[model samples]
Target: MSDSLERDALKEILTASIKEQRAARRWGIFFKVLTFGYLGLVMALMLGWIGAHESESASSGPHVGVVDLSGPIAADGDASSQLVIAGLKAAFEDKNTKAVILRANSPGGSPVQSGMMYDEIKRLKAKHSNTPFYVVVEDVCASGCYYAAVAGEKIFADKASIVGSIGVLMDGFGFTGAMDKLGVERRLITAGANKGFLDPFSPQSEEQKQKATAMLQEVHQQFINVVKEGRGKRLAADNPDLFSGLVWSGESGLKLGLVDALGSVDSVARDVVKVDNIVDFTPQPSYADRLARQLGVAAATTLGAKLEWQLR
Candidate 1:
């Protein structure tokens, strides 16, 4: 009876050990798969395979390289200079590309980001003298969008498309009234007098307002200079509201010299570039990169909600 009991006990221990080893092996396989997936995602992003819009079909002959300029032109916006510049560079570097087209569709955002892209386009133009760059406004290209548009050799749009808002503005909210209604008092401290110049919780300061207006005027002037330099002798010199932060239809824009003509992406590619095939070279963010950026944007927006300051 004792011998039989010992045999049974040893068998049970062996069975439990086997089960534990099997579970360990399963977990090890699961972790390896997870790690491989993560590494593959990283590789795809580094190779510019994911999030990027590639050509639909392969072309043997000359093609018109197109890049999209959609959404706001802010640093954290979809149409940021970093992505646009990368797309433009890729399009320009392609030997089979006869010309480059920037299909702009935006309400404008940041002037600084726009300026950076403008500089890059100009540099690329000089480097590739044979390849011409053009802008085709789809919906709207106002303020900063127009700033970047001017860098192109020609700007086109549909007859109904909105174009041009050549100006700068700084805007904010005054929460003092709201706070007073709610019986809440704000206590903000600063080291420099001008540091809290535009704080919403504080009373409005005439000096700060004037300073802000003057700064906007300076930026507006810079915008005007770029338009003049790019349009060069094309803009209607007699129109007083050309730089007055006013927008116009494509038809009016054509007459005002804001747009060269009424055209679309297809038309430009076919008639101007003389090619039917349009290859979009927009650098799409990888899934992981996009997820990371989205999270960052959410965090920024949440933080910004605490303040009431916005610039245009």
Candidate 2:
């Protein structure tokens, strides 16, 4: 009886030990799975693969939609006209969006890109006539940026914000003198006489220079006309330096009628739009898109591509 009882106790102990081991293994697996799941979630969030749709969603009630136009306006840049227009289109389409705000902070870039955005803004504004569109300048809004900003119903800027560079420029380096010094002859053979117009490696011709100047003047006049049409009687018509490719402080810009008033996105949303809920409708480019754009820009730079016309 003693031996049997001893055997029974041993069996009980082994069974209990086995149960404990099984429980521990199960807990270990649960924890391992949880750890892996948490890591994957973090990676997804960091990679911008998740949570983008949530942020891009507009509020159900009345809110001000904001589209940021920062950096140089270029085809390959984040602040490109295509991205800006996409944001604007989304903002206008949203029923909850009471007013649209363009938060601009750009030095300037391509005239064509800027012009395209400007035209789109006008079209959107006309379509959404009830919804007011405004441009709130941050830090600086000059040249191409101003070109687009004028489409807004009103433009606001800080007291110290830089504003206004209404001009067009085409700049390039002449390598003719440098080639002479380096004992390198430019063997450029063009089918047409004006095909090599303003070629950096060749000596600049007076006729080509005149043609280029005339082109620049034409673009500059277009920029000036846009500002006039946008600002209207608010502009100080007597100010000679207004369109002389000069930048001015926001306070001065107000005096010169470049900006309508002094305000920010928050203030404008709250006071002007009568709603403080600012929903950002800026088109967030994916990681792959950004990488591809960078590659393209780098390739262009490597090929020594020059902008034919710029607002800067």
Stretches > 4 Å off in candidate 1: 1-59, 292-312
Candidate 2 structure quality by residue, lDDT tens digits, 1-312: 999999999999999999999999999999999999999988776566876543346546788999999998888898888889998999999988999999999988888888999899989999999999999999999999999999889999999999998888777687878889999988878798887878878888999889878978998899888889888999998989999989999999999999999999999999888998888889888765677777876422311335433334
Q: For model 1, how does the per-residue alpha-carbon lDDT over 159-269 read when each residue is reduced to its tens digit?
A: 898888887766657888999999998887779778787777878889988987787788888889999999999999999999988899999999999999888889998
Clash count, one per candidate:
1, 0
Q: Candidate 2 — which pairs collide? A: none
TM-score of each candidate structure, all chains considered together: 0.80, 0.81
Relative to the true structure, how large is the alpha-carbon lDDT of every model? 0.83, 0.86
Quote the lDDT for 66 in model 1. Answer: 90
Best by TM-score: 2
Model 1: which residue pairs collide? 51-284
For candidate 1, the C-alpha RMSD (Å) to the true structure equals 5.1
Evaluated with lDDT, which candidate comes out highest? 2
